[model samples]
Target: MARQVSLATQLAQSPSAWNGHIAPLILRAMTDVYITLAWIFQDREKRTDEYVKYGLGQRKLWLEHFKRSLVERGEKEPEKNLFVKALTRQLNAERFEHITEVNVGAWSERSTRKMAEEAGCLDLYRLAYTPFSTAVHSMWTHIAGYNLRRCRNPLHQFHRVPEDSDLEPDIDYVYRAAKYVAKTFALFDRETGVSVETPSSLDQFVESLAHPTGEAQTDSPDPLDDL
Candidate 1:
């Protein structure tokens, strides 16, 4: 008879068996959260700019000066406020020059890397896991009409839901992307002597070198989508 693998044993083997799959998944999840937050902040900034430009109209000069002064003050002591810190660190001065030019996707990619650099691998791991967890929880909540926070394996919660449903596709895509990120990072860890296990395939190692996209599109959503 074959020996049954315990959860502990399965998890113990994961660093070697599933590192490749998990790395991308982590990256994908972080990307999603970063992109969503970027959109929210960018939208807010756009509305504020519009108000200053149009609402204030002929008084635009005064409004612009006030805005510039506010930004300068925020830059001088950004650490005093969390929002200012984020804006200064994530949204560079050049990018903030024109609200319309803000690309959440691009910003998220750059910000994530900056986070990884300033913090450490573990910090990046947390950033990736937190949003992925929230996304999975949200998916289960929508399908079961109840929270699935207590579930041992949130991924299983997805299986109980419909395949063609609105949230399912997103959940699946995020999960896959997270897996890819985890694998990539794990490989990096091993290469840098921070991890014990090494990746078996170079495919993930190669993929990590390429830039991440907004999201995986099964079909071409638009011709300019890639751009």
Candidate 2:
């Protein structure tokens, strides 16, 4: 959680990273990470083991792809063999290539939706995660509505085409990202009864929005700002 939030904070520093085109991807990933972390804490030993194995399996799967690429195109691209061998050696530090089992399915053998349901965060999955998935997957529902605009030419049939969207920067994504980090902190405290001296990044972000003179801003803040 600390690492995730630290990376998020660094990304948040870049205003361009907050755009609708990119922010949803990070927010969606954060939601998955949070929900998965919460679920893992419920059964740390077993789930963590499963998670580690799944990651290794994925690495092996990637190594196999590289190996196949080398075999198929070794003559044309000889450097790939050296890179693949180097990667295989690095991966073998933990478990041998022969011993590491490959699992092509979900690590937990349960879908993230099911895990989110068990973790009592199905609402987050439904509202934020699933909607953001449309953008990540480039679903017709999102691209057609967001990226494509109808042509104004009356002579030709109204046809939709992609446009370079010029959308105003929305602070809402920052708030959502901060909220996820805060939730992670809260989850950590809840699970381990550990308390830190400093305030969460979310609180700091909201507090930073105040006028420098220590007076509150006059405008009505978004309700989520209270988070």
Candidate 3:
């Protein structure tokens, strides 16, 4: 949860749309982390050929797009327009031709739910990732939840704005992210033969979050003197 913590810190330091991008990214990464653990727990070698095929297909698709860009610029010879040395050019033409042979598509066939099920994180996916997807997709659900607010008037009117800096998501999501991060780190340590320990403060912080007593109390001995 280093990533989640870092994102939270970033949001606190400088709240903006660019920094807010971290929310969706963190959700996406959580799923990926779980899938990675699943792959590690299972025998990943069984999927080597398929992964390699997927990689090559992705490379070919990228090169095709690059070639199209060159053509649009009216470059007579797209092949000679390569300023940067790319893997597509280095690959044997025969093997590269196999990119066309694979028709499964560039992206993984597995859905987020499938990956989550395999990774044993389907609950987290439903609780966190699915809700976060609304923000990522700019759906009306997110718009209504975050931006729509009632005006302070006797008539009780509603208004929408382009952005809302005061919008803070429920703290439950933060706790969930932290928990995922802790679990991921523990998994990494176990798999890599590392002996890192999570800090006690993380647990304390989560505990404090659950039982908030409002703003911190002042420590001055003469409490009435300041008033």
Candidate 4:
């Protein structure tokens, strides 16, 4: 049987559809990190004995898979290695300093805004604000999910608690940290003017930045040989 075609499908099939699909997905993926962390923290508060064990197990598996994928590409390409290194450094710094330092607090906001202005990304800043806020909401949802799963209190009962309330500073911190990383990457992409379509791979991302359009591709050894 032939499937019925819809106008939406036809529009999606068009080459110039201007579909903004990737933006949402990127935001979601980054936000998921905060959501997962919120669950871990909420479970801890509830004294759910299995929460830590299960959550840590899940986190280990997820991090292993993510690191393996990043490392594989880094091994084959110099430019990719540099990007992976830089990303690792940034993530580590954020993790150490905590997300509150990067997200919602007055100092954090001032610093972030300054960086965005310096990078000439005020437009990206405006566009990403809602996505960043959405990510924070996703984190709250995760916390709510944990509370519901534990049967401690119904989600509706807790609905009155504002997201930025002083009740859950840790969760807010996690959300802020995640947003900081996203904002940084978005700024990098904007400044480099890298095309996100073809370069889905880490190697391609690094290569595109290292070798922008109209630049000569070198035949020499990998630039990251020393690393």
> Which candidate should be chosen as best, given TM-score against the real structure?
2
The lDDT of each candidate is: 0.41, 0.83, 0.59, 0.40
**Alpha-carbon RMSD, each predicted model:** 20.8, 6.2, 7.3, 22.2
Q: How well does candidate 4 match the true structure in TM-score terms?
A: 0.21
Candidate 3 lDDT by residue in tens digits, 1-227: 45545654453344333333345655556655555455445545655455566666766667777888988989877777654235455554536644444435523467767766876768767876777777777788876766565565646455554556564454544555566666676666766788856574458657677656664545524566569
lDDT string for model 2 (1-227, tens) is 96668657866886777776888888888888998998999999999988988888899998877767766864565435678768777878876567878999999888989999998889989999999899899889888877999989977698887987877778778888899888888988999999888988888888786545456566855577679
* Local accuracy of candidate 4 as per-residue lDDT tens digits, 1-227: 00111222233244342223223334444333323332333334542344333433444444446667866766544324665457556545535312222222322123444444544544545665445544445555544533233323576554343332222222222233334454444434554575455422334434565787867566865577679
TM-score of each: 0.20, 0.86, 0.60, 0.21
Judged by whole-model lDDT over C-alpha atoms, candidate 1 comes out at: 0.41
In model 3, residue pairs whose N, Cα or C atoms come closer than 3 Å (at least 3 residues apart or on different chains), thus clashing, are: 1-181
Best by lDDT: 2
